[model samples]
Target: MQTSSTLTPPAIRHDEWALSDVHGQYSDANSHADLYRFLMRWIDVSTHLNIGYSRFGQRHLTNANFTRLIDRIARPMLELYDDSVHRHDRRLLDIGSGRGGAAIHAHQSYGLEVLGIDITPYNVERANANARRRGVWPAVSFAEGDAQDLPIPEESRALVWSIESPAHFPDKKKFLHEVYRVLKPGGVFAFSDLLAVPTRVRQWPEFYKEFLRVWDVPYLETMETYSEALWELGFDLRKTEIVTKNNIDIYTGYARRYLTYFRIPGFYKWYTGRVRRRWGANLDNVREHLRHSYNALSRGTIDYGLFWAIKR
Candidate 1:
């Protein structure tokens, strides 16, 4: 990744809130509730908490179908198994499950029992409500828990799924170990996340550092690092692929939506006011971080990856 020194850095208004503080805020129920409410109102109607993937390439996607694209990203994980067996016996664990979208989809589409866990209690409650609304309440349940320290029992889940969520984890290694611990032997752990290209990170240190602060992640590991970690943790690294184009498409779609939303009368004012009130001085930092992320994605300083591994 080429570093552009010509780009002007945004002013940092909030010096008190460090990366650790931001991470804590995410786990704070009240804080995350406010954030989720804002996102639901402004981002997408379908309650997707992550970037949606686009298949027809970046040129053809619109905000209207962006939510559907999110579901599409999860389809491959669901299709990994044969659903011919008894549905009640098949358990799928969704780590960092947001609003139960993927959980409900798995239950309704594949007849699998889904257990969705999130760090925020409010998100867990919202997920349960969404599950009830989707009529998959009993089959799909949500709990408040951390991905790094899962509440699940050993050999409890047949499949552990995470969608664009591990990037938020402060410790990816511990989370991967937890996933391996909870999954049954021969079970699969599948996920998608933003990754830093090792070569690019070395070249663009400033951009990479800003990305960590903005993204609320401690560090972004390359695909090679992930494979090595998984292999060392007794996982059979089945698949790992770079999907940077899809990530670019998703960010582009979101940018379009943000612009459209800004055009709405008083929408930006109201949204910004709410965020500032809730987050205080950190608001400007948040905005700057997002700007940095968009630019980084466009420049290919970062990449999106999809990975699947079976517990050995």
Candidate 2:
């Protein structure tokens, strides 16, 4: 993957929380509770995929499927460190650890003591439940906490990880600061997420508006701004990989999969029930926006980024 020097455009922000609507409309009908559950499930799959877990399954990583992802993420970083000099009883922290798959995988497979945290109670609870269900309880625990003010002590964590969650944070700088604070001296942090770029330089405002309506998340920062913020917060750059070209293919494949998965007799009815009830008036526009995302991705106008850094 190639890293680009050109700065991406600033993320779009909306006064209204459009993401809540997207969650409400897309999940099953008549229940905001159900919407919450659906969001957690989606995050689990997305985070795993974002971090290189290719297989899609709800069950815990039982077969070789789970360990492959565990090794993929940790083995490279571990190799980069001095084996004889590094801490053996290293403490790892995972921010926004959806479903605890990554944490449990790390603990059981790599023998790393881990703590997974998420703001969503549903995710936290489900993750903890899954940990126990997999018999990795106590070793891998989930905590309810905000990423902005991490509960971990300063200079305590050997490694920190976040996948696809920071984009939702309203303040990226503060969130970066928290990650920096919790990481031990010389600790490594790995992060990956979608990058926002202006549709056209002069049409930023219009593109920003389109951005929120499409992703339902606010305040996604660009790769340039993100790197600058990390440096400002005292992190030494390790490696930056631009996954945009590949992510375009990945997301395009996802959209196709979504279409096939949701088009099933019972599944389509399950998905569009609330969408029709709540946004019946704007259904066409919503469909149009979804099409634009798929088309834009296929054309490579948008992309995802992955990077690693060390606390300086």
Using TM-score as the measure, the top candidate is: 1
Off by over 4 Å in 1: 1-46, 57-75, 83-88, 249-289
Cα-based TM-score, every candidate:
0.75, 0.72
Assess each prediction's global lDDT (C-alpha) against the native.
0.66, 0.63
- Residue 271 of model 1 has an lDDT of 65
lDDT of 2: 0.63
Task: Report clash pairs, candidate 1.
Answer: none
Expressed as tens digits, the lDDT of each residue in 202-289 for candidate 2 is 2445544555545555656777778888888889877776755433454466656655665586766656675566534233343445
How well does candidate 1 score on lDDT at residue 91? 82
Best by lDDT: 1
lDDT of 1 by residue, 196-290 (tens): 76565656666666656555566666676677789999998877878666655566456546655756768767867876675442333434545
